[model samples]
Structure formats: structure tokens, C-alpha cells
Target: MDVCLLYFEDCPNWKVTDRRLVAIAAEHPEVVVRRKRVETMEQAERVGFRGSPTVLVDGADLFASPDSAAGFSCRVYRTADGLEGAPTLEQLRVALGLTQEVTR
Candidate 1:
């Protein structure tokens, strides 16, 4: 699977997503992870960037909502706990189709 993490320089939440992706990659060797820095509104629009730390699996947004619009801003995720700066590790696992039996 090709996983691309789209982020900007200012958003700290991207790091959280990156770390979770790293952990997932460690367990799933087939997963290839990459990062893209969206620096401008034009770039964001051209790339369909919903927000910082957007995860794209196989070139599709993993958690995109119909209402999401491209912009250079922080992205909030709706996790089990509540609104969060980034998705939880469990969320990432589920999105990536990782089995629960696998642990870091």
C-alpha cells in the first residue's frame, strides 16, 4: 500500500500522524509511507489537500469528509475519544487494514 501523509510546516499534529504511520509501517512491511509538504494555497488546491496531516492511501484521502475543502490549516480528526489533532494509533491501524493482533 502506498500511504502519503500531506502536511504543512507549522502544524505540529502532522508529527503525531507521522509517528503513528511509522509504527504501522514497522508492523506492516508492505506499506510504503511518504510525506508531502503543502506550502501554499495554490498547492493545497491543486493537490486536493483537505488540511495538514491528511493521510492518503493509494492516492485517496483515508478519512475525507464530503464537506472537506482544500486549505492550508490544521486538520482535526474525530476519534473515539473526541476531537483530536490527529487520529489515534488504533484509527490508523484500522484505516491501513492492520490486524489487531499486531503490536508495536
Candidate 2:
């Protein structure tokens, strides 16, 4: 699976998502994590970037919503704990079609 993490430079939450991806990649060798920097609004629009830290799996948005629009901004995720800067590790696992497991 190819997981692409799209984000801008200023967003603080991208790193959080990156860490989770790294953890997932460690456990699942088949998973490939790549980062794409969306530097400008034009670039964001060109790639259909919903927001910073937008996680795309196999070229599709993993957390896409009808209301979400493409732009250069921070993305919020609705996790089990409520709205968060990024999705939890377990969430990523499930999104990637992996069994739920405790992440270190």
C-alpha cells in the first residue's frame, strides 16, 4: 500500500500523522509512506488537497468528506477521542485494511 501524507510547512499536526505512518510502516513492511509538501494554494488545488496532513491511500483520500474542500490549511480528524489534529494509530491501521493492534 502506498500512503501519501500531504501537508504544508507551517501546519504543526503533520508531524503527528507522519509519526503514526512511520509506526505503521515499521509493523507492515508492505506499506510505503511518502510525504508531499503542498506549498501553495495552486499546488494544493492541483492535487485536490483537502488540507494539511491529508492522508491518501492508493491515491484516494482515506478520510474524505463531501463537505471538505481543497486548500492549504490544517486538517482536523474525528477520532474516538473526539476531534484531533491527526487520526490515531489504530485508525490508520484500520484504514489500511490491517487488524487493530496496540501501537507502541
lDDT of each: 0.89, 0.89
Report the lDDT tens digits of candidate 1 across residue range 1-49: 9999999999999999999999899989999999999988998988889
TM-score of each: 0.91, 0.91
Candidate 1 lDDT trough over 10 residues, lowest sum: 95-104
Superposed by TM-score, candidate 1 places the C-alpha of residue 16 at a distance from the truth, in angstroms, of 0.5
* Residue 38 lDDT in candidate 1: 93
Clashing residue pair totals per candidate (backbone < 3 A) = 0, 0
- The Cα error of candidate 1 at residue 96, in Å, is 1.2
